[model samples]
Target: MNSLDTTRIRSYFDFPAAGRVVTNNAASTQPPRELIGLLQRCAPWYENVHRGQSTASRRTTAMYEASFDTIAAWLNAPGRGCIATYRNTTEAINAVMYSLLTDFRDGDNVVTTMLEHNSNYVPWHALCREILPRLGRRVELRLARFDATGRLDLDHLASLVDKRTKLVCCTGASNFFGTKPDLSKIRAIADAGGYPQPTGERRALLLVDAAQLAPTSALDVQALDVDYLAFSFHKMLAPFGVGVLYAKRHLLDHALPFLYGGDMIADGGVTTETVAWNDLPWKYTAGTPNILGVIASAQALRLLLDMVMPTAFFGGSGPLPRVAIEEVMARVGRHTANLTARCMAGLSEIKNLRVYGPEHRTPLVSFTIDGISPFAIAEALDRRGIEARAGCHCATLAHRALGLDPPATCRLSFALYNTPDDVDLATDAVRETVAGRRRAGRPRPGRAQVSTAAGRPT
Candidate 1:
């Protein structure tokens, strides 16, 4: 049980107007002081790394490689596993897709779920579109459906896997509902020789996209039996432009590199005609890497593991355990049977509102006020100094699937920093917005009238 100091946590971020009433731990997060200082120190040294003959370039390259070691430690990956520093999760996913396609044949299938962010979806879909035709093969996209509560239907996943299945990819925690998938169970099902299905296939490799889960909890790869895992630094409290991909050693050696360029070779020296390739990390890094961001990421991770343990690290109950970190999260989960309960509890008082996503959810929720466009809702909140996001959230498929009209949903995500007071402010702002619109007597098309004070629509 770690004792969390809310006051100390409060001092770290730059809150918005209205004394920072609007807060979110989604999209990205505020890094520590040391991360800022580290970036500031390296700002000027942003010259091309590994290309120069100078001592400074050599030192920078060393720092860059050292960052991989730090990332490996944080991820608890095998020492032999190759760590490729990427621009972001998108690039890493692309690399993985391409590399997997190099070895996997047309008959081989890779399984993913509906829960994936676009970052994980697009690359593979692109491969399926472009490569499947060439090889005369078919790629199957399988989703493990969830119940009304957003818990993954493991039984559904078990039904999908067969001998041809080569890779199984899934998100550790859902960004939409904050639902945590049971990876251990997934791994076991995949690896079990006697697969439930009629096919006599053994286990498939497991790839976890831990982008959302890593920030809130410690991810022990060995414990989870994950073969490959990828995540970004910016989401975890560092700046953007840097990401990490942990691929088991055998996979690294067998997989092909996505981008081809200078550093990724053993020797690209031109003797009128000569070219060779470099090893693991270098092979995948095609251009001048984001040295400063990589350094900052390494430093930021160290800071989180060291200084910010209370809120980000420790989890339990009571004074000894820290309420804001663990206990509150538990209460939030318990307070509502699902996302619908939790969000409705907060927004039921607000007139003309509709919540989106499964009733069972994570700390994040998206909703829309009746007859209000998402953009208008966001602007209204901004006027009241309530910070929120309005857009597709890079999930066009999900929006289309949900049959959303008028516009995209307005998103408000919670983190350890968010208090119950924050929820109250957000709910009140929605109520005020709806009431103010009604007072203006503007007819909201396809929208129903309701009493705000009564909480739910009469």
Candidate 2:
């Protein structure tokens, strides 16, 4: 199954066998069975990496290190040296925050936007509001606004960045709105801030939380020219537990390690008076890492390629071809985009249901009905065997910005394996749920029949 072949692609996963509708992919993609098997196979030989001399140890270490290379190629980064794995995107973003702790001077501000997931916003909030202030260095956290249509206010974002702005953080895609911001334009705005760095560059550093974008999009860090980028593998059909942080080599070389011990130290370079950190990527990787998760996550990317291409990549390892990567992701994007549109069209017919964001969105639709709680809607969908996510989706700020009374919405997100039928089912499920609510309450006979759409199958 290539990117366009959902029938073949869905075969690799166990979800279809179970007759499930997995529309909450923005939270996490269901793992394909081969990855689980690959993970299980590593159990017998699993050994602590980079510290032992045994054959099993060396083998694990080699595969572990090569996973970095695969991740780098996936992002079109310079090399493995730029990739650092973490538990998830949240921790990866926190890593950057800790690494830059002392870099913020008094009165300096970090400008982020209202569309951020709490993973992106909370860390900066704690850093500037809690951590830095107590240490007698007061840094400010500024939020740029988004419009009623869920489009980011780019002009407002630019105005938020000035000489005092040390870094600008933004989401590449909104998990709630499903809106993908123009990263190149955001990069230009960040550069225009022109905050002088210690390295002599005159620009505020830009960090992107790409948790929502990386699944279907081909993310080229070089092309984006972002200083730092973070994304989680769980959202990309890889099993949970691994995320990646891509920083410019120079920034990694200069910044202090967020966590220090074990492998992060230079092999024999630790001394009482002086200590040397390891090379580019490892300098940031401290302690015994999530070995199996990293390796399997890398293979997950390979499996994605194999699903999209006539040939296979999961059977092999190392750098993926850039052209193939681009083609595969574009195909996946187009497929999911079509599915989202279809889902929206089916959803639009329902009375009192309102979808968020502009017409063009990522592979997700978040919406709410006037009289129903989103949580209640999600529970009703669950009874129908459909998987939908409710509440803020960790985008509390975006919800609050929209003046959502309870600050929540029901969201249906898609992946490569999601079918048009799945979208229709989810949308129909929402319609039925809304119709059910009307029947239980004070029902208008005419609107009730219309809402329930008795002509359609329940």
Candidate 2 on 1-458: residue-level lDDT in tens? Answer: 33498888888999898889998999999999999999888888889899999999998999888898899999999998889999999999999999999888988999999999999999999999999989999898999999988989999999899988899999999999998889999999999988989878899999999998999899999999999999999999888899999999889888898898989998899889999988878887789999999999999999998887776789467568999999999999999999999998999999989999999988999999998999999999999989998999999999987889899999999999988889888988888898888878764555533345466422
Error of 1 at 436 (Å): 2.1
TM-score of each: 0.80, 0.95
* CA lDDT, every model vs. true structure: 0.67, 0.91
Question: RMSD in angstroms, candidate 1?
Answer: 6.9
lDDT digits (tens) for residues 1-458 of candidate 1: 34434455556555522286644556776666667777677666656677888777877777777777667666666652468888887788878888777556656666777667888777767777667668776776665666555466788888777777777888887766567888889998678523222222356888888887776666667778787788888777788788788887766766678887767777655355765657766777787777888878876655543343434422111122222333433433342223335455878666677666555455677777777788887788878877888887665555655567742778777654555666777777878888887778754778766867887654
Q: Tell me the lDDT of candidate 2.
A: 0.91
